[model samples]
Target chain A: MISKKKVIAVGAIALAAVLTVSGCTSRTDSSSGGSTAAAGAGDAKITVAFVPKLQGIPYFEAMNAGGKKAAEELGITWLYQGPTTADAAAQADIVRSYIQQNVSALIVAPNDPDSMAPLLKEAADKGIKVLTADTDAPDSVREVFVNQASVEGIGEALTDQLMTAMGGKGKYAIVSCGETAANLNAWIAVQKAYTASKYPDATLVNVVYAGEDQAAATSMATDLMNANPDLTGLVGECTSSAPGVAQAVKDAGKTGTVFTDGLGTPQSMAPYLKDGSSSASILWDVQNLGYLAAWAGDQLATGKTLAATNDVNADLKGIAYDSSSKVLLLGDPLVITKDNVDTFSY
Target chain B: MTLDERTKPAPQSGRPAGSSTATAKRILPLPVTGQEFVLIGVLIVLWILLGIFTPAFLTPNSIQPLLVSVAPIALIGVGMTFIIITAGIDVSVGGAIMLCAVIVAKTMVSVDIPLIGAVALAIVVGLVLGVVNGVLIAYGRVAAIIITFGTANIFQFLALRVFGSSTVNGIPSTLEVFGRGEAGRTLGVPNSFAIMIVIAAVAWWYLRHASGGRHLFAIGGNANAARLVGIKVQPRLLVAYALTGALVGLGACFILASGTATLDQSVGSGKELQVIAAVVIGGTSILGGRGSVIGTVLGAILVQTVTSGVTQLGWPSQLANLFVGIFIIIAVGTDLLRERARRKA
Candidate 1:
């Protein structure tokens, strides 16, 4: 009995020792994996990985679809993943895994730009080409930013479209997602300034944050309308809240009375646009934007500098790339009304 | 405690049991509890203040939508109050709602199911999830939070897999009868909120007057002691969790109705926190000895009021979170103090 017990103890120790040795080796191996790949053969497929703010949402999925298409056309491996929620730490984990996998190029639409700077630097140091797409990490060591539309582009479009519906507007409020989202805040800033400059009669009454919640956006839009009885317009500032604001107007039995235009996907905004609750959805072609990001990542990976004007494809022609600031510009934001909503499925 | 000792009225009843022949005289508690009274008072003060500040706040347009928003949370809170009463918590309702909403939304679009059929499907799916949670926690002897937290992630993954990486668009508005639209109202009251009130009333009575209800209190107070006295602890816990799942299914339908025509992956995001916040603020003890469904109903109303009031008053929407957090702390603080005082006495 004592001999059997000793054998069991010895076996357990052997197993623990074996596991400890293997774990240490794998740890060192992964750390060195990135460096070796950066210096290794050119025969392998050029891998481009893009991580969005969140996965499974229509906006990002369309981007993923575009990225996949670009991968097929360019003959490179396109790896796409993101945190299920637009959470920074979770995004960072996925980014780190991609970095370890030694993907040739890494792209991120960071949820938190400030926190992502160091991680981007770490990837850069490992010799992996790094870039930002959709949402930029301005202070990071990224080589390029694949921008879909300028802050002025979306903001002016939203304001202009809603003003047209409101007949140059009376009072408007903005329902935005993510209180601290950099891009949304920039757009809101532009909306505030543009509304003030362009339309003398239109007033920006309030801007509320709904934190990527469609239902909260709807309820808040209702409250905004109630708060300002004469309020004629609302801008749903994110994909989720875009339809949300329109739903609020419809539910309140004030469809034509209150005009809403937001950054909504076409399919989601189709119902509202047809019903006349929402005037227009101002957004760039999301899938095309994704395709551009993957293409840019490959360009950076291959050490090919983008020209001032480059033809990407038939759908994406004469795309502008600013060499000094490293920003790749996808042209004007597309406005989706009832007439054009069905044309773009994503 | 012996069977003789256990047969006596629970301390929560606030009176000795079997002391008189008249069953009316042995009524467990007053129709309302102290926490509920306080909640009612706070709600009144806030409403009056909101009415004064925002002239349109008291109108049907504003109030009707507010009630519509509160319906789902309170409806789910009824089941949550039951689970908390049995010393259990289900934080997976958010994920459960996501799965149920997506499934129902997909079903409604593809199968063109009617309102009754849609609702029934959601409830059954939710019940199955609840049973999965209940069976693992109740019989497996795992902590409720640990099990529910793990299941929450699992449910989210399943929901995401079902989504297949796209939003469920063009959802038919057949469920609009429970929405905030014109069809969702009856005689000036929102149909969804009215239904929630009826359900809450039934729950309030059951928790206060039923034998099964008292057994839940006993089990929560001490599961082993209750088991010794012949209360089926595991089954009781199972029933509590399963009941919550069923309510979550219905709540998801209300949520879908209240939302836009498109259903996205974010459909039920952060909803568990909202429902849990409402339940705790409604004066249900987190530790699980004493609570009321009325308090939960009122609590949901109060939370929604604060959210709507903050927006109507043109205050930064983040202030609503701060106010709800303060309310939860105060409710739990007061509960702890009361518990301490009771023990000392």
Candidate 2:
């Protein structure tokens, strides 16, 4: 007699086999295989790929949208791809895959810039143009960097905003996304120095690391608040920390009392803004950064001579390309408040 | 098996003779297993020490969120217990969770589906993924770890495809009942934690009393022998994986509710390892034929408590893993010492 276990097992196996076959048949006909971005083909249109630190977050997604716009305007193939997690090894694999594919140019925001330096150099040696955007790989042999404002400017503005919200004189805490994150460390260093010089009365009580988990961030934020009941401000130093800090403030019923702000996306912070749990979020125009990077990539691909003092394309008029550093600078920070949060969708 | 019995072969093997079966079959109500008691003792000591040191660690505000986080890991531990009991493992649960969570999150975004519908879809998706793992391992007769590893990649690929390059934003709060919000609680206890207890209790009963459940232990003990005794070994193996998949679906909802409205692509990263650790720490033999869902639940609780305690103590978050590694060694070491003592007795 066929046992009960056999029936369920055999039945499940049959069902799975059927699903696999069906999954193969119904696969989407996209240009890129596992990669999300596709090329809009035109004759002599060079394909340039933009690899982000990770996928499926608002920040990089906004960047990809900007790249797509640039690709459409410039008539080039925009390949946007990266690992789903912020893992350096996985990112190296993606870079290797791109190298093997031999795309015209490569733009990347490296998760581990030092480790990716050799791979970036390899791509550049093969006559494939290389550039770093959003987060620079200064050690790598990349052609240029597309920076979104100066690091000092962002840190000073972020600390200034938090200090103003705290009324310039109370204990506060800072929650960063991860300790090993390169960009966050740079910003926090500047923030600490700025705080020391500018807001003498405000004491930075805690600096906690959340490790990219929103749940953990919320817990740490709550713990920080509870441990120091007299704290006046909470600064979330990354996109994931803002909501988590806001949620903690809201959960503790200290919305109006404990002011919160961070570097976060508009969509993630809208609810917090409306509820008064957070006052403002400081971020640069990420889409503009992506656009400038893709434009620079196209310039490199078409064999156009990009001089140190050359005027940027008409579509991107205001951005300046520094010849000495090869850095294309996007403008100042865009502060998102309750009144203007609706203005920015991403 | 008796606490002191070691030389006696497993009763499921049917080679232990009649007297051995009689001795092993002595009625003992489920109050405490050896590993479980040790885990409970350790947890109590840890909690007391944390409370004495931290002062705030004993409060509800500190404890409630910790329990809320534990709910999903323990819930998935139920299925993992079954899988391990059959001498099998499913490392693709993390990938399976991502697939279920993303699909459910996307559905909540596009069409305002009811909570029940959302949950059913998650479970069904998980079951399908489970079936994939089951078929390959059982029918193809491949090692469970290797097969699940391959399927993990496929499931992750499927989940990323569903993500479509952007985070699923503005997820409706249909899953708030399982979240850390006020709505997720009943009598100051999180509903997710309560549900996990109920499920674990049911699983405990089934694993102990049901004939079908005993068949799983037989298969794990010796698949060839199980087949000779008219037990369907392949089917039992398949069921273990499918059950884990179903739990992954429900567990994903707990995960979804536990987070912000924005569901990122890193939803279920590193979860499979956590579940396996809990099961192993619960004293379940990796070689199979012995385990309890109750122990798995307690193991999950113990793990979460250590994490919460460390953070509350104002220590570096990185130090929590060092403690967890030490606990795993201690738990396994104790088990090994006990096994040796039982053999000598």
Candidate 3:
């Protein structure tokens, strides 16, 4: 009787396992086998694969869209996939899988740049075109870095936009995500130095970390406002917190009295921008960033050196590639407001 | 465990030995446990300290939003307390929340669902998912943790498919009556908090006085013995889980009302841990058969208070996590001692 019961239990577990596996078939298809571009492996066309920080997020999906568009226009095969969570080891495994597949080019927006550095070196050793985009691993032996925007570009823009709403003077606090996020910290440093130099009247009261959780950001933003009742400005240092701070301002009925800005996607920030809670959203053309990464990958695979200022597309013109630092600039960061919010689909 | 005392064949007549004597003498009829007093004391001290340290911490502007944030976690904790008392768990609640919130949010966007309709839709969806969990664990004779964990992944997969690579933007404000706005409150009390209190009070009475609720304790204590006493253990267990699911549905709507106009896929990530943490810290014995809905509500409030207090005090966010971890360990330690004392007596 015990054995019979055990068998039934085992069968139920196995059934659930099958159900879950079938449900995640799409994610598995991409991460395990790359994209449909992998079907043309034997074809003569160059295959440039871009692995994002993670999958199923609007940010990386937008980048993937741009990569696919580039592949169609440039006549190259663009493959895109990444881990489901923003995890380092899982991401390393995905990168390793692409390496073993021996794709023509592998571009990674590494979740952990240090751990990914060795993998990039190994891929470069295998003669696979290696490039980093959206983020960078400066110490790695990569051919080029497709930067979304410079730290100065993002930081100064955030400050300028918030200052515009705060009228260049008043106390503000920053609700940043991931205290140890290297990129966020870099941009914050720039915001501080630029604000001190340019908007000297504005005082940064405090900077708190709320992680990637939107609700936490909202509550923290509320706390910040309560902490500093006279505070007139706030900065949500990541996509999650961008809408979060704006929501807090609105919920507290401080929309007109206080202001918020952040690195938010157009769609997420549209309501806030329209309601006058958020002054502006600072972001780059994510699709164009993806296109540039794929374009750079193809250039490297075909042994072509990029011009200092290359015209990749009509929408993306005079893309600057600095050989000395191996950084390709996607020009100034695009400031998103209610006027242009509907223009971008994502 | 009073193992020797309860093993005397339950007297063949009077209340199944441990069911009455064990619950009444040691636990019930007191309305509140010793653990609850300690929890209340800790909350009082923390609030007083926070009020002193951060002057704004005691103000209405700060406390109102903090309670608004606490409403959902506390609301869900009421149901989680019932499930945990039955010695079963539903770790899939986070994934369940994600699925329910996205569905309700989508429906509201496409069809302009009213407040009652949106809430009704969420509860029904949550009920269906809960039923799936109930049937599998009760009938299949599987461990609750393993079953719920598996269902957790499946639920997330379905939710993400519904999301389809984009966030649900421009969600209508129809659900904002439960939000932190003026519409969400009545006579300075947030409607969501008031509603959670009413439900938790009902749950409290049902668990304390109702025969069906007492049967849950019996089942959690010993399923075989409860079955011998004609307690219908499987159905009681099923109700525990299904109840949690319905609460998860209501809680998801509360989460929606509190957030911004957009709902992302991260709507309910890591919430299971938070809910379980609230349950565990509420002095709910993981071993089963002992807990209170009131304690669980207080646990949720205490946890949110710690988080908001940290921010208001301008302390590092990691400190809030540290305090919560410490509270969990201490609560568990005290529960262990009490269980040992009960066994010896």
Best by TM-score: 3
Model 2 chain B: which ten-residue window has the lowest total lDDT?
B3-12
Tens digit per residue, CA lDDT, model 2, A154-231? 888888888888888888888898788778889888988888888899888778888777777787887777667687
The deviation in Å at residue B328 for candidate 2 is 2.1
* Candidate numbers sorted by lDDT from highest down: 1, 3, 2
- Higher-lDDT candidate of 1 and 3: 1
What interface root-mean-square deviation (Å) does model 2 yield? 5.5
lDDT tens per residue, model 2, B119-181: 999999999998889989899987687688778878988998998776777888899898777
lDDT of model 1 at position B22: 54
Candidate 3 per-residue lDDT over residues B204-278, each given as its tens digit: 999988989899888877778899999988888888888889999999999999988889888999999899888
| Model 2: DockQ vs. true structure | 0.23
Best by DockQ: 3
Order the candidate numbers by TM-score, best to worst. Answer: 3, 1, 2
What is the alpha-carbon lDDT for the whole of candidate 1?
A: 0.88
Model 2, global lDDT? 0.81
* Candidate 1 chain A lDDT trough over 10 residues, lowest sum: A22-31
